[model samples]
Target: MLEKIKRRIEKHQAQPIGEQRTFAVFLPLVKVDEEWHVLYEVRSNHISQPGETSFPGGAVEEGESFEEAAVRETMEELNVSKESIEVYGEIDFIFNQSHHIRCFVGELKHINPDQLQPNEEVASVFTIPLRYLKENEPEYHTVTLKTEYNHDFPFELISNGKKYKFGKRKHKVPFYRLPNQFLWGFTADFTHRFIEIISEDTNFLEGKNEK
Candidate 1:
């Protein structure tokens, strides 16, 4: 199944797409009980956005492709070798009010969770069942915030068993969650959309098989 997904993804890469600002998020996978688990990272406190649960990824660098940046960032952040990860299909493109993000799923044949290097920007690594995300209603919260260009917009955050409230300042506004790991901002939005796409695809395949 993983190999099939990989082939599907590779086929999509051949098509030319419009030029737009894009970033990549990696959905790392591991197998357990013949099912897949998705890996996520808890951002370290030393970083600007501390304690946020996010995929190991970042902005695409100048002169670098999105796939290159995804693979590079994942390797750097998780200490996972590039050779071991198999590229699966991409998630839908998320258009943030500020920028756009492209997400990809990748499979890791052998993952050493204990060897995950906590970079100054990454506190820890964690995994949750892909099936859980497919089935559950993720909690959401409202956040109002100003962009870097000084524009205010209403934002949303997906709560991961964390408490949060809305707060504002003269220049900035945010949804302040209790000082623990909560998935919010672009990361949360990307994650939610990714799961939605995967669920739809899985259902479609199931229906086809039933026929």
Candidate 2:
């Protein structure tokens, strides 16, 4: 049995445990007027979260790498070819029991936000100057998480049964109030993380707008 387990481990590719839906997003940075700007998409009515702000990204398909999915989603959403995009590198990624999101930072050459034609998934495209984002701070909110169990769950198997003590884990949601847009949730977390890296100050964003 030990030998069999050793053989299995040799061929195993380590990945996140449990079932996870993988995703990737490209933080497309463009140079406008000698300054850098970050582009975002407003979800159109065709998608579920219409009018919500987001970056170019989608689910990672089977047999596709993280970068490949990011680039493919960018091309399909922005209506641009892969040749127009130059992927610099990856910053960091997010992993949870249900989701794994990877972010890639790169530049978009020879094009502006107004020039690109987006797909049905995109309602419109807009740009936020990196300098402006670097200057402004975002808000953070911590909310409680609901606890539920399967109806068939065996309550008698554990001590205290229905009154058993369970650890409290709250969700940390972020909000970025741009001049005209309101960014929040996981997307906001990604944006805040990117800013932290580029600004070289992990604690740069304080709770100025916390609630």
lDDT of each: 0.68, 0.86
Instruction: Write one digit per residue (lDDT tens) for candidate 2, span 1-211.
Output: 9999999999999987899999999999887876678899999999888999998999999999999999999999999989989998888788889999999989888787888899999999998887678887678889987678999889999999999987777988898887777588777788878887877744334423211
TM-scores, one per candidate? 0.64, 0.88
Off by over 4 Å in 1: 1-22, 32-34, 144-181, 201-211
Worst 10 residues of 2 by lDDT: 202-211
Model 1 compared with the native: what TM-score? 0.64
Q: Cα deviation of 89 in candidate 1 (Å)? A: 2.5
The CA lDDT at 138 in model 2 is 79
Give the per-residue lDDT of model 1 (tens digit) for 83-199: 977887787677634557878887876776656675677888877666666555456655555323223433334453133343453322222132354655566566567667766
